[model samples]
Target: MQGKAGNAYLINELVRLVYLTYHVQDAGYGDTDVVVYARAEAALERCLQRAEREQVWRLEPDDAPMFEAILRQAGRQPA
Candidate 1:
């Protein structure tokens, strides 16, 4: 079994992960970025998966960064 977080908690974490990934990308930590971003994406996916499994809620655009915002935050470069 996996640990679970409330919807509010998940959103907060999602925001953090989004920023953390951008930070890591800019830092150019090589395989370290892979390790971290994989975990971050997995966390996002797992949150949605759990929500679906429990029939509680689904992923909402309101919870995601806008494309412009993501670009701004992540910078205009590949990871």
Candidate 2:
């Protein structure tokens, strides 16, 4: 969450759901930490605005575990 840029988006579901992704500079000095937020890209703009007002903007709680699991399987993790 430090020295990073955060991003968010929505997925067209039964009801639109917002999600967030972030990336921070790699502590060990890589090309820069990068978070590829494919699932949430479509809703990014709105999600960011909401996060600014609410102080929290992340995938809905019920959806998070599954999202993270997918990321892990893909060899990625939230930054």
Best model number under lDDT: 1
Per-model TM-score, in order, reads 0.39, 0.29
- The Cα error of candidate 1 at residue 75, in Å, is 17
List, residue by residue over 21-49, the lDDT tens digit for candidate 2. 23321323223124333443433444456
In candidate 2, how many clashes are counted? 4
- Check candidate 2 and list the clashing pairs: 8-44, 9-43, 9-44, 10-43
Candidate 2: list runs displaced more than 4 Å: 1-38, 42-47, 76-79
> Where does candidate 1 stray beyond 4 Å?
1-5, 12-16, 27-32, 56-79
Residue-level lDDT tens digits of model 1 in 5-75: 25756555665746665676667732333444555555567567767688443344443334234435455
lDDT of each: 0.51, 0.37
- Strongest candidate by TM-score: 1
